[model samples]
Target chain A: NAGLTDVREAVAGSLSAESGVKLSADHVVMVCGAAGGLNITLKALLDPDEEVIVFSPFFVEYLFYSDNHGGKTVIVPTHEDFSLNFNELRKALSPKTKAVIINSPNNPTGVVYSRAMLTELAEVLRQHTSDTGNPVYLISDDPYKKIVFDGVETPNIMELYENSIYITSHSKDLALPGERIGYVAVHPKCADAESLMSGLIFCNRVLGFVNAPALIQRAVKNVQDVSVDAEMYRKKRDFLYGELTRIGYSVVKPQGAFYLFPKSPIKDEVAFVQKLAEKKVLVVPGRGFGSPGYFRISYCVPDKVLEGSIHGFENAFSEAMK
Target chain B: NAGLTDVREAVAGSLSAESGVKLSADHVVMVCGAAGGLNITLKALLDPDEEVIVFSPFFVEYLFYSDNHGGKTVIVPTHEDFSLNFNELRKALSPKTKAVIINSPNNPTGVVYSRAMLTELAEVLRQHTSDTGNPVYLISDDPYKKIVFDGVETPNIMELYENSIYITSHSKDLALPGERIGYVAVHPKCADAESLMSGLIFCNRVLGFVNAPALIQRAVKNVQDVSVDAEMYRKKRDFLYGELTRIGYSVVKPQGAFYLFPKSPIKDEVAFVQKLAEKKVLVVPGRGFGSPGYFRISYCVPDKVLEGSIHGFENAFSEAMK
Candidate 1:
């Protein structure tokens, strides 16, 4: 139930090498995917009506996953640049707070939280724990950890906090989302880490996942260090970023992942998305991610498709501005 | 997500051929396994505090699976020969009863329900559904459907009842438990079948499964008719059954699967199990399956191991009788 030992050992070695923290196979539990990892982690940590905190412009499914285990979601807004807003997070921390989920290189927004930022966040959580006499768990969802552009490194949450759980998947890195394979790494120094691991293993079965798919577990063990070339995504990102910005659409440069979240020319992003769809260009409304007045464009398509959408993007932006 | 279209079509065709019912891809929902199928089905059918009926000497996980979806389990005892007891089932039905789960060729007992028996059970459920104005779903868990012995055929529940859901996994028949792949087939004639299927698909994602693993789904699509050799399991069953009964253990002649549930020599089956363990023979106490005074022996091991355990079985039986 914890997982196949050799697969867990390989993941432990890989995470340890990247995080500079000593980890063992005993701390790792294989899961269906990042979705599966989050579900099991929440199930292990939550009692009824306990709260979980998430930054605004978050993965929409985070709300559903928390609710699945009877945990309420508390949304805290990030800064304009999608950086951690510590004031908001500090206010969001209450005795009912069981966990805080951080995703970087984030989904929808593509902003990667820096090490200095994480250290400050950890300090705030530590102070809250001491003040309230309740432990706050940091859950880092890192499916895009290997898809970062430039030389930016995703700092491991385990090294940043004592009571943290690190989860990741092969979906974005290996481009195997349909395969549904991932793992959860519990910090060795986590509060009640042993019991948490046992609970995760127990929930994995009772929740009907049983274990991660066996064929993928065997297939991915040897390829732990391999990932799809980020340059391809980088090229696609550059093309869409350049085209959308040149077309007079206000956009922030994405550091990682394959998304570009740009402010909508109009206040209602959903209306703008419908206009773009009429022009044969598709993008998700930011309201879907809990932030309105903005929209998300996924740049993981072929070059021809991205190039072809340029005309539609230009027409939609010009019409919206007019 | 519903799943890959081609895979669903393949499964639909295979089920149609086997059950002689006209099924389409729209009626099928791919799942992680039989466990995944059951969870989604129960989640879709159950409201809070509703009841799901199961037979005694059942798979232990049925209780947890039912409770996972806010449903309570009401166990109906089977007859002395491990057949369906209609009187207990009739007495157990209530306005709160939302579903009835049947597993055949059953676990622990390996008792396969004949087509005539299933017809009678369906009639009883239909009468109950009419008596109380609430629909009762029949969920057939058929992981061991293809493992029947002595040329006995297992009836498909979809053909037997209008409000039936048929779930099967490649885990047992294809001998691929670790692969974690299966599908749920909702009878097209089921009450509100379209809405039920939509709920199942929604629950499949929200429950953290998302979909069945991609590799196995693709692989099994072409081999739906293939299964492990039931004769091999039959040989092992024969060896264990012949030897145990010859040594004065009262055992049932199994018609399917690979289990033998025998009356324990002593009234306390747990103590009998411990004695057997001391003699290097291991069998599960019947209390684990909601039945007592009998123990279960699984004969799916290699022939050499079955042969080697005979002496232990003999010694344990003699000591218990003395």
Candidate 2:
């Protein structure tokens, strides 16, 4: 009755084991996708004007998702190295802050948060909850959780904090974005976890998702262990990152995910991306992701496509410099 | 980009022609399901505390859908025959009323509204709209439009009224409830039609559906012209109705869809339904649907199952009387 389908439980259990989180099937709420999970969780946790602090360079959809539930999005920029900026994040916390979303193997930047970083962040949240009595939850948004590079492990939020929630999709890991399949797992230790799960189920219905499309749920059930070709993406990311850095662009080496974020030669990343697009190369400006002076190149395409785009990347950056 | 996908437009066109409504692809919004469509449309139309008048014996979810977006649901009781009680509906209308939802070939009661009833209702709306100068849009929820009996015609809502929106799911007609695919169509003549379309598309995205499941959308595209065998359901409805009537149950004959609504033998519809369930026959109590003194039995089942339920219904009815 609580969206306790056997297949949903199967994947939830599999995910629980992998994340080292003690989650029963009752803690799992199947949703349309990670976005659906996030929206519903926000809907459950927020009242009008509640603040949800998000790390900068986050998924742009976070702003809209937070606003949809009548919540304010307080964006705090990460450290210069694209890692957790505890100083600024601590400054951002308030009684009004209902949650802080962490998207590791993070979008745009492609930087994965280390376990130590997450452990400290949880401690900060714990202190805030005790001091303010506001229960500022940590929400882990983990689309690239399974897409880590060079054996970098994504932290399981449930391990770090009793008040954390997880919203993740098989979009990247299982390559099922078009399928719109994901699940929300509440840690057993999450405050009022049972009631929160129920609230999510209610939001799922009221938001009109009703439930995730059933066919994919069945497919996911049978193939819960299988995943997309992560090695292929890793190679592509390496090639793209190596080429851009050799071309004299300042770029952080991505530990996971399929995107390379390189500093634009020009001050305006949007203009730089525009030039790139004109040269038959496509990239999203980092400004759109709340991180200026950098642009994101998705390395999810065939190697040949990446190989062909090398010249465009060179031409666009050189042209932007001129 | 607009959410006007090729397949979405194809089905929208097919539904437009079939329903005798003049609608372009721009008017259609492919949603998660009929419920999804309803929620988004309500989100688009209703402001906080605005009133949405719904008929009694309605789908229980209507209240929740309206309330999800801060709209107040005003339940107007239907006629004793379970048809439109226009007098009550008219009295229920006020400046606060933003819209009215009509679920014809209705759920729970299975009442397929006649064209005359709809024409009069539209006239009532016209008068109200003119008197208050507040455009109260008519929202027709038509899941059972394709499953009508006795050759009753579903009103071409656009022809009956200029200001209307039609939301329906293929779940019933295409036997695809698990598929969770449907669309919302604004009449070409609807006031602020362009804005309404934009509003629906905006609501579709912000509501976290992002879009309907692509797999089912593609499937429905080519199968737009095909529908489940309504005759099969018609036969089942007849069988269920005949058996119940023979057993001295007072029930309304369903014109469409696959349900029988019979007055419970006991005053407490919930207890009566509980008794039926105790006899291994499951039915929804009328109170659940805002329509008490009755219970609903879905006839979308095998003939043998209906045959098998005979003794249980008889036993449950007799026990309820005692």
Best by lDDT: 1
Q: What is the Cα-based lDDT of residue B305 in candidate 1?
A: 88
Model 1 lDDT, residue B47, Cα: 87
TM-score of chain B of 1: 0.99
Instruction: Give the Cα lDDT of each candidate.
Output: 0.91, 0.85
Docking class of 1: medium
lDDT of 2 by residue, A1-322 (tens): 2353897689777867777886678888877888889989999999899999999888888998888778999999887779989999989998899999999888878899999999999999999999998888789998888887788887688877999898888888987666678888888888888888889888888777888777777778777677786788788888888888877889888888888888889888888888888889989989889989888888888889999999998887777667
TM-score, one value per model = 0.98, 0.93
Q: In model 1, where do residues sit more than 4 Å from their true spots?
A: none
- Give the alpha carbon lDDT tens digit for every residue of B1-322 in model 1: 8888899999989989887889999999999999889998998898889999999899899998888777899999998889999999999999999999999999989999999999999999999989888888999998999998899988788878999999988998999978789999999899999999999999999888888888888999999889999999988888888999899998878898889999999999999999999988889999999999999998888898899999999999898888
lDDT (10s digit) by residue, model 1, range A178-200: 88899999999999999999999
List A-chain TM-scores for all predictions: 0.99, 0.96
| Candidate 2 C-alpha error for residue A153, in Å | 1.5
